[model samples]
Target: MAKSKKKQQTGPDIRAFFDSMDALASEKGLGKDEIMEIFRGSLITSYQRKYGPDARIEVTLDSETPAIGVSVHKQIVEEVEDPSLEITVAEAKKHREDAAAGEELVIEEEPFAFSRIGATNVRHIFFQRLKEQEREIIYNEFSHKEGELITGQFLRWRDREVVYVDLGRAEGVLPRREQIPRERFHPGDRIKAVIKSVELRREKSRDPGPYILLSRAAPEFVRRLFEQEIPEIYDGVVEIMDIVRDAGFRSKLLVRSNRSDVDPVGACVGIKGVRIQSIVRELGNERIDIVNYSPEPAELIANAISPARVAEVRADSGTKEALVLVPDDQLRLAQGPDNKNVKLAARLTGFRLIVKSLTQFGEEMSSPEARAQLEQLFSPKTEEGAGEDGDYTPLTELPGLSGRLISLLEQSGVKSVEDLVELEPEELEALEGIGKTTATQILKILEDVVSFEEV
Candidate 1:
């Protein structure tokens, strides 16, 4: 009767255990269902480690109270060998009169009250399991945010290598490779980064939680800035056709207007360049070129080399080559220092451009040898005529050539008919604005004019 009364007190202790868990769940903002699961898992793990692998135990939390109960289940066999899994048939019959061999029986028992060391071990296991579940939750939450821009506060710098940022809910790492050169980060600095990736680690380890990779060097950073600064771009009225960036130095954006009345460049530049200036300030004074997109290569190239006047744009129909002519005074501006402007324009327009000064074009056009060659090829039997300069004759005045075709030939260095006759089809095609097909047509026209001279 004393043993029976002692057993009656065990239920109250189980109820108190669960009541503590409920309070913890409320304070930590953890869900009751998740906490209950973790508690059950910890109980099973602790029991197995102490009693061996075959130990059969069930752990449950009381629905209305903060109580936990652990029941050891055993098979009622004819004889008891393992105290953890099997019980004697006589012992089982004491609890259930109809119990028989191979029948399963459950014995309700209080967990052996743990010693100080054992209690610490149990608490450690419970917290470890909870931490593992929390990491998994964090991993799933941030994984979906990859490639998005996030705002965080600088926490600290480690080994002068990695920068740690506190992202409100989680910590993120900014590796040296992802940070821009010369950019400084200090403790408590407000920083922005693009979520490069999220990497999961082994569940039960504490070396570092699931890694959140952050970057300030990605090209998308500029695109995201434009989207934020330009209402038209954010609302989809302006589309970014292409972007070419030199990381922190300069970036070029080709934008197109969706509506006929909306100017994409004007929208991005804003009034007095306020919109673009805001973005520039954020990027450490990086230069931004917001050029209008054009389907025509000539127009596109012209816009790409902005603030540099284009005297002429000659494109080869077959080879898709373009020669951009700028006045001699504007050559320096067109090509920029060390050809950076031209290089950026090429990348922005998707065209391989040969930039030539107008003076150079004029030199090739007005050469005396070129005029004499033209006269011999067009009219070998006719008298030589003089015009402005030593022997400059309008190429259109030559028989069998239209003014437009003459202008095309002049732009291509074929100053006279003699120059045209000296060129092979391949050589002619190599000139700006000329293709194999056009070369063939021009050669045919020159040959007919020559045959007429013989007659």
Candidate 2:
């Protein structure tokens, strides 16, 4: 009578227990079946620790309803060999009517009969497994977001070197080296950064999930911000060729328009500088320059060094070097704060840019060596071979080229056979007066005199 009363008393509590488990599984984004399986294993461990390791125990859980059942299975023998695993026939008959020799008798166990220590062990196992499962879920979810922009709230600082941001399910780590120099953040402040890496750490001392390392200083961070803020770049009307940055100071982007009507720089800057201003505020007022991209090295260098208008750009194709001439009054602006403007421009254009004022260039031009070089450059060449071997032939002497084509080539700085051979077909076609048909004719005529492979 007393056992029947106890069973009735605990029935509601068992149902409530399973109900809470279901709620927790749903809230954690874990499978209900997996959660139940983890608890079942925990129960098994508790039972084995109390009643010899070899004791047979079975745990059953219902999928359709919140119900749990546990049972103990022991073999019936004439005499018990192991008290925990085997039972005598007389004792087994009390639980089962069909108890016999060499047969197993099943006895249902109470929902839980855990001692204090056993209960603690079960709770530890359950939570440890649950936490590990949750960590795995978080790791898998965030791994795909590497190199993407994410907005998170600042949580706190660790060791005065690492900044922690609450990314909802996971915490993002912003190391000191990855942060923009001198940038400050307060708790609960919203911050934006690019996911630099996702790493899974297995050390026992650390948290289980993969570490999401974030960065605000990386060039890619600025690239993602441009993509998000600029409608033309997002929709493919304008393309970003490259980006260079000195974080917290300045960043330069090389952009080009696929359509002739849309100016890449104007689109990025927006009407009265609204769109770019929003990005600037987000970056803590870092200077951003939008430079137009050009295939011509001289034009590209001139465009890259901005804010201080370049008077002229002189480039050497062989050495990949460029000299940028700016107005004497704008020399300080061309160098920028800490000379970062010219440095970033050089990186963006892939040229070693030497910036000089018009006055400085004039002074250099007055030198005897510079004058001699200039004279050699402008002087008309006689019908003389270019190299010592005397095998060099001039482009005018080559057949199949029209007089007009030769004049256009010379006007665009392709004077000799050596200069003509260096230009690709697309580059020739890009010349001011050159057409696709003319470019094709030029390549064919050059092929007859010089084997491109030998050159």
Candidate 3:
């Protein structure tokens, strides 16, 4: 009767272990069924190692009480060649008279108390199995999140080469190459990055942890950030048309509004620059230009050179080239420091932009001798129209001549058709916006318009 009473108490202790597991599952946001599955496998391994491979083990959680049950399997045989695999037939008959040879039987025994070494081994196996299962859960949870932005706390450096981030359920890695150059990370700092990839290593020798790769240097990172901060973008009212980046230095994004009422640039910039500022802060304060996308090449080129006021945009659609004219005083601003503005604008628009000052245009337009040569080439057939106005007024009437170019000709002192005929194509190409092809085109046009009589 005392043994019976002691066995009753052991059941309660076993039940308590299951209760603890349930509480842990609830606290950690893990499923109870998953925890139980892992617990079962751990117990089987531990029991087999401690006792024998054929040791009977049945694991169950008490619903009314918090406890677990582990039953060992014992078999009866005529002779015991393997003690772990069989028991004496006579002894088995004492417990079960119906037991026979080759008949395996399960024996319910009181929960065995583990020794110090056994207990430690059980714990190590349990936790190791639990961690592996948890890693699998985390990988499954986050594998679908590629190309999405996730926020995490900065953890520690690995191999002094990779930055580790503490995601809620798993650790994520931001390799040195994936990080923006010159960016620093410290423990406990909150950061955001895009999930680049997730690798699962299931080898028996490996730790079984997921290889999570993250990135902050990708252009898609910027796009995803805007999608988060800008409501219009998330709702699909605005679309990012193109992205041109210089990595850490700067990026230009071209966005267009899907709805007529929506202002794409204004939406991305947000009120008081709040939306883009959030992104800028994350990217180590990289400069960003949010330009409104335009279907017209001329308008798009003008927008691409933002902060540089453009007087006019003359585009050669055939050659995909544009000449942007700015005021004389704005030339420095148009070109930016070391011509950064023009360089970025060219990348953004995918066009060769020649930024010229208004002064340069005036010089190309106002040459008097150049005008006389043009007038003689297209001479007035009627005497009635001939007058002291040199029979030709504004040079802009020519197909390729803009008002700015006419002003440029006059400024250079080429006052008549004779002087224009003498000018060389190489001299014309030296102008800021005029390339070799444009210079050749202009020379051909001038030659066709100027007559020898006018010269």
How does each model score on lDDT?
0.75, 0.80, 0.74
Q: Which digits, one per residue and each the tens of the lDDT, describe model 3 over residues 201-282?
A: 7757333568788999888889898999889999999999888766687778999999999889898988899878878988
Q: How accurate is candidate 1 locally (lDDT)?
A: 0.75
Per model, state how many residue pairs clash.
Answer: 7, 0, 43
Maximum-lDDT candidate? 2
Which model is ahead, 2 or 3, in terms of TM-score? 2
Model 2 accuracy (lDDT, Cα)? 0.80
RMSD of each: 15.4, 15.2, 15.5
Worst 10 residues of 3 by lDDT: 1-10
Off by over 4 Å in 1: 1-29, 51-56, 78-100, 115-118, 203-207, 315-321, 329-332, 336-340, 356-455
Q: Please, what are the lDDT tens digits per residue for candidate 1 over residues 1-455?
A: 00111233245666666677789787656798888889788878887776567889887666665445676678878877887788788887776677778878876555546677767877898999887777777888899999888899999988898999998768999988788667888877898888998988775554367889998877778888888878999999999988887656677899999999999989999889987898888788878888888878888888888768999886553334467889889988887654667777877876666677888666755989755653443342324553322333445656767777788888877786545654656778887777787778787876666432101
| TM-score of every candidate relative to the true structure | 0.68, 0.69, 0.60
TM-score, structure 2 vs. true: 0.69
Candidate 2, residues 295-381, lDDT tens digits: the string is: 899998888888779898888765566778889888888888646687788888877666788887798798998777545443444
Off by over 4 Å in 3: 1-12, 47-57, 63-67, 72-98, 109-118, 157-161, 185-188, 201-208, 270-275, 296-302, 305-455
